[model samples]
Target: MPEHEAGGSLATPAHEVRDFLRRRREQIAQRWADEPLFRTVFTASRDEAVEAGKAVVDALARVADAQQVEDPDAAGFSAVREQLARMGAARSRAGLSNTQVSSELAALWPPAENLLVAESDQASPEELRAWSTTLSVLLGTLRLVAMQTALSETQSLIDRQRLQLLEVATPVIKLWDGIVAVPLIGTLDSARSQVVMETLLNAVVDQHARFAILDITGVPTVDSLVAQHLMKTVAAARLMGAECVVSGIRPAIAQTMVHLGLDLGTVKTRASLADALGHCLHELGTNIVNAAPDGAGRR
Candidate 1:
């Protein structure tokens, strides 16, 4: 509905367009499969690739059926939008780059137009112009939806990976009944500290844990910021009804703490995870005894 009309009716794609697509559907499928870029991006076996190409033609038929070429959000075009979104996400998981998707989408226009032009009764210049201009606009709309859907799906994948890494970095392990351990490694930044606090507090609530051990054995060094983060974690755990016991106080770390006058206050401290777990077990009225002083397990 632009100002470029040339004395012809400006209307949607007529039923004849759908008929053209249906009559030459097989030819469109074969040509789409044969496109070099399409073959490269889809990377399927010969028959399967052609079949996949045919599936694309099927989607195009639906779009033609709906006649919402210029209006992607139209109710009738919802199926086509879903098809495009699924294709975009599938291609992204297949390791196809954004550029390859664009190239293949552009490649589809030629074969589709050829089929339509051959079967169309619009032999006049005005008719030809209308068909060409309309098809061009439709292709542009399709490209926009396809690319945006692919980008959105890719961003979702990235966000999922980001969350997985966050979970992995702040794992909470249940050492025993009423005892959970959160092992800290490397540097303590504000972001990781927050993740740690949330994970520990959640574990305490989930397990009804009375004592949560925060082990910093692999921590490289301790700064005022690191101390503040640890204190915050302890405070948060206490609020969740779980006492915090910090372990893995290496000799160097102990010396640094004393030199800096870093008072951990009334928070319990231990030298190793084994010691912390032993203390936790002892406080919980659970004890481990040697069996026959041999390799037998504790009773």
Candidate 2:
């Protein structure tokens, strides 16, 4: 062969080696592109892809070093073999073999490059699905909290109304044929007094009573407002064809009533419930027997 032809022949083999390396790299990349694991890694976060790519590079480097060493007994070859063994042990611990790692590495090469180029903030379907599930849980928790708050507020309002209603709706006892006794227990405000007046008037008409006993024995004190309310109640009882008997007048209450200048001309006065009952019997032409109480009907 001619000298130039010999050189050209030698260069042709080098060119072929370069071409072979290029073809092998391209083939490995394409094969990885078709793999499901490659696609998953590519679509994963950049940090994940980079980590997987590094594992693949370490594996390839170990295999390359083993192949490059010549004699197995030589120092370099022994060192390479030890490195390969250590890499193998690591791969085993990681739940993969050398062959499996190589295949995965080849498959993931393209995705690794893509991951490097892709934006970090771009979210994948898996990430979005996870986020949506988290958001749904949060919204459900918020709704539960809101419902609990509403229920608590409603219960509080109902409790307050119940207490107010109890103050106004407490039952009275009829001590005589014509006289009924109502014991005031708590603060007798104007609003509460109006309710009490209406209740007493209704009871008097229903029972056809000639007299009612307004007893304030349990009451601590009286205000001008309460005295005015009592006077109005007496007037209302008179309009309903019944008389009122004021009883259990404490010293403070008497002083307040006198100070307020409330006239009880239409109503009778008594010192106690028994006195009111006796007076009512005198007016009604009746007497108390060994009988059960009025409110103690067949319940």
Candidate 3:
């Protein structure tokens, strides 16, 4: 394209943007590094940072070229938008908090404006204005993309933690030769109960246990809701061919269950976890007793 030739302005806005990006890319990155967020780091290596800065400049140049042809949300800008999203997620996973990411992104606007002012000073007034506006819109789009990535990644992390807690909370221990006990401590909600059911059933199959105990001694209350959860877990265990015994019925909880007319019919109940395990051994025709020492027998 031909030059403006009057005041040494570029022929078009795109040309002007490309010229500034090529000339002042280093200054933009240096400015970003001076920001407090980058100065302290949660950043990648120096080479990675420099490469990322160059990619950003290239992305912005593309944005300027497409400004008149498309908006940030439109198909024309999808590639750059996706690139920014990846960048956002990468930043989050690298241990940058939302505040740090925001600070760095917000810090970008000033250096960008400075780049245009210092490097493109001789551009036509209209072309300069268009370029600035285009950059602002693209930067704003990137900011929004970053926020969305943060939200999505945060939610993912929460889900993983919840799954981990479920695995830890519901453990089925093999208590005897053919007995397993699932000693539930907290209040049993529907979600937790599902985990309990799955754990109990899997243990029954895996351990070849003949009896399973659903001990709820640590449960704080026995409302109808909680009673239902217990019943579901028991049913799941029986379906897997192992008998289930409910344990840890406090006086108050028993009273509540009776008052609520919960027909836990035919499901054996024990006052404590020890009672449940003892009963399991009894059904197997064996009872545990402390063995006297060889020398002190009958003394």
Pairwise lDDT winner, candidates 1 and 2: 1
What would the per-residue lDDT of candidate 2 be over residues 1-299, giving only the tens digit for each residue? Answer: 11222111233322322232233444434444455443453454544444443343333333223332112232322322333343334444567644564454343434423432242245554443332332232223222332333345557779999677766555667776666777777777777787788888888977777888888787777776776788888889988888888888877777777887766666678877778778888888886565566556644
Report the lDDT of model 2 for residue 166.
64
Q: How well does candidate 3 score on lDDT at residue 154? A: 72
For model 1, how does the per-residue alpha-carbon lDDT over 119-178 read when each residue is reduced to its tens digit?
Answer: 765466556656666666566667877787677776888999877767788889999999
Candidates in descending TM-score order: 3, 1, 2
Candidate lDDT scores, in order, read: 0.76, 0.54, 0.72
After superposition, the stretches of candidate 1 with alpha carbons farther than 4 Å from their true spots are 1-9, 12-16, 37-51, 74-95, 117-122, 173-181, 185-195, 202-232, 240-299
Which one wins by TM-score: 2 or 3?
3
Give the number of the best model, judged by TM-score: 3
Provide backbone clash counts, one per model: 0, 1, 0
Better of 1 and 3 by TM-score: 3
For model 3, what is the C-alpha lDDT against the true structure? 0.72
In Å, residue 211's CA in model 1 sits off its true spot by 5.5
Weakest lDDT window of 10 consecutive positions for candidate 2: 1-10
**Candidate 3: pairs in clash:** none
Looking at candidate 3, what is the lDDT of residue 59? 64
